[model samples]
Target: MTEKDFIPKRYSESMEHGSVSWEAPSNIALVKYWGKKEHQIPANPSVSFTLKNCRTITRLDFSKKENQSDFDFEIYFEGNKKEDFKPKIKTFFERIVQYVPFLKEYKFEIHSENTFPHSSGIASSASGMSALALCVMSLEKKLNPEMREGFFRKKASFLARLGSGSACRSIEGDLVVWGKHQETRGSSDLFGIKYPDEVHENFKNYQDTILLVDKGTKEVSSSVGHNLMHNHPFAEARFAQAHENLAKLKPVFAEGDLEKFIEIVENEALTLHSMMMSSRPYFILMKPNTLEIINKIWSFRKRTELPVCFTLDAGANVHVLYPEKDKVKVLEFIKNELVAYCENGHYICDSVGDGALKLK
Candidate 1:
């Protein structure tokens, strides 16, 4: 909980680099990632592709203090200094130090920022902590060469999971799964991939236009929802459903069978919402605009058999996945129908993006 809580250090060292940074992209589930068997860890080993257009860039630098005995953490939203979020953050820094040990004596200052909404969904935590994890790991590498990738990967997830559940998934891309702690220990079967995890192969022909319907953020955080799973009887059911769906949907996506993929994705989307509805404090993030888009999409499916489909992630935003070949029609559909039924007159279209990395 604090620097004093850490059980002393096994190794200690200090070094400096100009600074390290990473731009980690957010990912949406074409097949949906929902529920969890063990809190922040994945329920059924869900996979996702990194978005190309949006991401969060993070940096870290250290300075030796002549007076202070402990490390401190700081965060900035846009350009304003924000230290109120430090308690949980400092706790995480302690975890990082305790696990790595060699960094225990040194002081650290974390500089993190998100490009999009401060916390208004759209997978900000996904890219935000992914960037953070990599930056921290980079610092560790520069200071200690004995640590391996496997050591940092697990340690990074452990640190990021405390900050946000989705943050664990942000550590990897193309296709990433927050491996169950039990399975990750030499279990090669944590996840499956039917299609090659390539940017162009899975996404170039596809377009997922996000319809930003303001739901004013959820009353419950995923962390709170995750804690609820301890008592939520239906938690196991949600986990099972996500597993079945992911296994079946992977092949559908690989074949580039749009119709099959949409069906699977939409069903998985509904299942994710079902978990939220069934939670103890029971809340639904869907809006009237959400259902209207769903209806129109279904009707279009019936009339034209297009591959367009809808997916929601704990918020009112409707991410409509369609073919880039249908861009004009897609844009027209958003402008015209949304004016008639959506929650807002404004929206942004984002394509699938690259995974987390240092910028050029």
Candidate 2:
């Protein structure tokens, strides 16, 4: 056999792919996925873009280990034991097994890592699960050649949800919005989305700028905060606001309207933060530095009459979106003022980039 033929192959009742590797990025939701319906699916249909610059690299290899009672999953980020992440990995495995029982027949050795800092509220779940999804989907595509274009991606996203609530959005491309068919709206399979501009054209160069405000996301897990929202008295009206924002932003997104985009995105992010404030225990991600930066950006824009606007994710990180031309001045502002408070505070400037890709 030639060198190519020397590659070992397994043909068994269970999926037998030699190895699968991929990298996908974490997404910061603009219009958030707040509530869940069946299967913990989101109540409003949401959408987002898969970012390119910051992503998790994952590799899955299987060699038919002996103690395959059902499934075994191992995960790591930044080369350290991710003990807290095991349950979700197992849960995701169980979900996959529910659909394809044979995959459980073989033991899986899985390794995952994020390019960005861990536990820093970077939405690692989004990209981490996404990379895993692609890893699994690659094996699926190899084992089951008949799989269709979007078949594996969506299914893997649904499976990724079992790993983390925000993770489901990571499996697709840029412009990933998380929302699903509202039961009230008479739809099932209602969760994260990369909705194909149903009524208008999709923006080609959608972009964002991320400033790592702090590395202290351990303060509140999105999961805990999410549960708080569910029981809050204003949850219903708050969710309704998310829905309304979705409607307002979707059309502009399709049209690639930047002004409307800034308006709606800022409002949606603020709306999410507002909920965090009113939640019984009352959580807040914005610090003095956070607002100072925000005020400065708005002040600069208002003074110079520039158009850039800022938005915040669940954590203290801030995302500023503007035309690519503004990158120089924007970067200078961050380098000078934004990092003054915290020694570790840094920023990565990224624009809307392409979706996930295979490594092996």
Candidate 3:
């Protein structure tokens, strides 16, 4: 749907005070979207696996105020007031106010927390922003009780994208696609949509074991990385490759071709890091242990003939993906061989999930 389609009609109803809460999961992109256009539009199409265990839970409480001149809000994280986070939330409210329209009408208290460590290569913004977006949409739904389920989800994702581009995908589950691609029906740059075609059973409940190679703040944030793509020497070709990779995955997904899936996913991960290294002011996000873990994963897969493979975000951590049937063997291998590469021997075991949950 177009951006205009997301703007709601003028509302006649009003609410004095209320509260809403939601939990939204993080996702791992198989076909990475490394660059973006203005308004959080992705430069190329990408698909991801929505994760179950790593997520953010957010609660929003709203009360009517006498003055409706400016947006009013207080933010808290894990039961503590977070002044540093206000700017991002303020910016988000500003971006979404045009569509939600009720931001200026009430004072809001937003309490949020993440199940996993923040800024630890886990795409916390995707889950955090999506959870907050779902809470805001709940308030909107209260104002217009007639809003359909489909529209609610669509607009929630639409608003989430304004907060973080990949956040659009966190609103749905299992497999979600963001950015417009010719091969993906009903895909849009405005938000993410579930893969419309049949997905092979092989992909269901797919496992993603994230190895925490480093938990510190990234040397280069995702925003800076995305901006680097504007004049990047290989930006055009990289964008084209994402589209081509996404297209290639369709048949592989449908046919349960794990070998082809591994090829595309691993290549996409390396390609992402390659772009970072090739930028004008080049930087590498991967740590030494990150490479070690990857090499170990490759060796183990080769020796065991398992469907295990690794993907990297824009950080030092590694996301090890494998089918559910191989979970027993994969987890054992990870603990015995790969855990040494992680920070403090920390890692998260997660699998595919079915979208966000409304807590209240």
Residue 258 lDDT (model 3): 96
> What TM-score does each of the candidates earn?
0.82, 0.86, 0.99
Give the residue spans of candidate 3 off by over 4 A. 119-121
lDDT of 3 at 33: 91
Lowest-lDDT window of 10 residues in candidate 2?
1-10
Candidates in order have lDDT scores of 0.63, 0.68, 0.94
Could you give candidate 3's per-residue lDDT for residues 1-360 as a string of tens digits?
A: 687887888876789998999999999999999989999999999999999999999999999999999988999999999999999999999999889988999999999999987756576999999999999999998889989999999999999999999999999998999988999999999989999987999999999999999988899999999999999999999999999999999999999999999999999999999999999899999999999999999999899999999999999999999999999999999999999989999999999999999994
Considering every candidate listed, which one attains the maximal lDDT?
Answer: 3
* Candidate 1 worst ten-residue window by lDDT: 185-194
Between candidates 1 and 2, which one is better according to TM-score? Answer: 2
Clashes of each: 4, 21, 0
Q: What alpha-carbon RMSD in Å does predicted model 3 have with respect to the real structure?
A: 0.9
Candidate 2 vs 3: which has more TM-score: 3
Ranking by lDDT: 3, 2, 1
TM-score (C-alpha) between model 3 and the true structure: 0.99
